[model samples]
Target: MRVISLQPSGDLTLSTDAVKPSPRPNHILVRVRAFAVNRQDLKIGPSVKDAGVECVGSVEDAGGVKGLRVGATVAVLSFGEGGLWKDYCLVPAKCVIPLQVSPATPGSPLDPATWAKLAAIPLTFLTAFGILDNLDLRKHDRLLIRGGTSSIGLTIASVAKALGAVVATTTRDPTKAPNLSENGADFVILEREGGIKDDVRMMFASKETFTSTDELSTPALSTTRINDSAGADKCVDLLGVNTVQDSLLALKGPGGICCLAGSLGGSGSTSFNPIKDIPSGVYLTTFAVDRVDMGKVPLQEIVDRVLERGEYRLNLDRIFGLEDLDKVKDYVEGNKARGKVVVVLPNEL
Candidate 1:
């Protein structure tokens, strides 16, 4: 089967290669209709694998996988730098989530891009909310999201807002603030990119005026954190290295968790004294969505949750065909698109 293979580190290219296409007992063969991109695939520097993951497609075939049939519309969850770019990629059945394959009736406002729009929101939002799920995010908690303009960051902010959390997002681009604000970011900080510790405290503190309102419903969080130097019950960092130290330094007292879910700013040693910068009570964890491999988490429940609510949204940057892959590859590698860049299969699909 022809596939897009990263022949060498940083050399992701499309090449045809023969393969024994089969599925594991718990796997399925997706006749890929569309695949989505995530920042995770773009920034993971080097690995032994041929390419990255984050795809959405259909079940062309199955591994005797139950509850899914051939011709069923579906989306693939790319765990290992996903394989959806190619015409046919075999994935574990657990990673495949079925969408309501049946199309809506005419004039139903049926959008062909519906699945693609929904596809891109998952990888990043899952990474964000899944990490928050670990932290027990409460609606009342002060959540600070840095790098708010990135797809992951924006998705995180959106999910948090939907859950009723007081979400504060930081971005240097003032132009992006309008959209972020519309999506539920209560506080949009025009960040200057340095000394964010105090900036974060101010962002979290800036919302105290609402404290007296009974209409507010938030999750379990310490109200004491409102204006303190150690505010922010949680910090969702989707940019990694550029923001980890500030996240740690800015976390509130006991139970303040810093979730590292991205490497967009590059990886490794951050400048900050763990002992001095991080409060003794603060918790730090590096989260990779793959960590959820062991549980019932991989099922289609979460995917369905987003679709059912109609709350999840994606920018749906552009769509490409399998034959137009060279152009698609160039745009993705160049980071030239605004949101999810999808590869759509031919009409034969």
Candidate 2:
């Protein structure tokens, strides 16, 4: 099998001599078609190791798994052991969601372009959906998605909007606002040079002051109250400690939930005084995609929605081949793409 492994020099090396992975009793062996790059891949440092987290492929062997069959198209979320960037990879049966590839039906076909799009969804969509699910999002609720231009951020905004929530997203670049808005953000808050917290507060203040009755009635923002603060019903904080305080401050008081789903900014510890940082009655929670229960993910519904829409709306910033592993690493490390970067594998060895 061909695999992309991290070398001792901290660079990814594609080698065709890699040993093929076999399926466990409860796992399936998949012949990967395409896989998406994620920020987590950067942490797989200087070691000779297989290092991908998600892919879309076909089941080469079911390994006695009852429901899965050979040759079935599947999307694999490699949480237990992160390595799907190869010709053959082992995936737990529970993490393998069979996809329908019929355009005449309620799903997408496994064409090259569609496979690339499907590759972009698993980890990103699952993480976003898990966060929103944890927050117990409701119709007409106002959601503030911090770091809205990132892949998961964009997916959260789109999924939340599809679920009838009025989505407000934050981006450091004002130029990305129109794109975010087109992707389902009702409001785009530009992070000011030095005062992101104040800028967020000001944006919410404007929402409170000028938001219309029709807007409030259109499953956008109803008269929802949590304590006395007039702000977002819930916030999806992807920037971690760097922006969590501002996220709490932008919520609609005590009943609001802030889901800390990522540390895209930095993972360093921060000092925060809860009494001063968190708003009264508000709740803070953390979500990790790998920690989420596979049984609880609405995989079928998510796929159905994507197919029904007839297109994958999440942006594909770039698609690289297996040979470009080093370039992919550099591009991701440099944060050069606003959306998901995928690696499409050749179907044959």
Best by lDDT: 2
TM-score of each: 0.79, 0.86
Worst 10-residue lDDT window, candidate 1: 206-215
**lDDT tens digits, residue span 255-322, model 1:** 68888777666676766666776677888877777776523554355555566555655556688766
Q: Which regions of candidate 2 deviate over 4 angstroms?
A: 22-24, 103-109, 193-195, 206-227, 310-312
Clashing pairs in 2: 254-281
The whole-model C-alpha lDDT of candidate 2 against the native structure comes to 0.79
Quantify all predictions' global Cα lDDT against the true fold: 0.67, 0.79
Candidate 2, residue 293: Cα displacement in angstroms equals 1.7
Clashing pairs in 1: 27-93, 31-60, 52-81, 52-82, 53-81, 53-82, 139-218, 139-219, 140-218, 140-219
Q: List RMSD in Å for every model shown.
A: 7.0, 6.9
**Root-mean-square deviation of candidate 1:** 7.0
